[model samples]
Target: MLILQSVAGLLILPSLAWAISEDRKKARPRIAAVGVVSQLVVALMLEG
Candidate 1:
């Protein structure tokens, strides 16, 4: 359950940051997606 929560947070936080950002023009969806993917990859690598 803890691990699941951690993963969910990793996925959701970046999206939430982008969603609530004041500068929508600067926070492109592609950048946010890339950040999320990179974070997930790093997390998985650390877990191993």
Candidate 2:
């Protein structure tokens, strides 16, 4: 479970970067970042 959460965090970072770079829309990047942060938080919670 912990390993899966870590992998999810790793996957989300690149996707967030890609979304921020490719999309010109203002709200998309914010949404992507929020997703990334949410993943990180979940991962940390699981680890803790």
Candidate 3:
């Protein structure tokens, strides 16, 4: 689970960078949503 979270974090990095650099304005909100969800998942993983 920890490894999966780390891999997800790693994957998000480059995609986030591209989103920041590219013209994908619509993707920003979706990215933010994913980030929030990921944080919640991580919290659940840690607490459990």
Query: Residue 32: error of model 1 in Å?
Result: 0.8
Write candidate 3's Cα lDDT for 1-48 as tens digits: 986976697678757776677567646667766876787798779979
Clash pairs for candidate 2: none
Each candidate's TM vs. the true structure?
0.65, 0.49, 0.44
Q: Report the C-alpha lDDT of model 2 over 1-48, residue by residue, as the tens digit.
A: 977876776787666667777545545666766877787798689879
Superposed by TM-score, candidate 1 places the C-alpha of residue 12 at a distance from the truth, in angstroms, of 3.0
* Displacement of the residue 15 alpha carbon in candidate 1, Å: 3.1
Clashes of each: 0, 0, 0
**Root-mean-square deviation of Cα positions for candidate 3 versus the true structure, in angstroms:** 5.4
Report model 1's TM-score to 2 decimal places.
Answer: 0.65
Model 3, position 22, has a per-residue lDDT of 55
Against the true structure, candidate 1 has what lDDT? Answer: 0.82
Off by over 4 Å in 2: 1-27
Give the C-alpha miss distance for residue 2 in model 2, angstroms. 12
What lDDT does model 2 reach? Answer: 0.72
- lDDT, candidate 1, residue 13? 82
For each candidate, the alpha-carbon lDDT, in order, equals 0.82, 0.72, 0.73
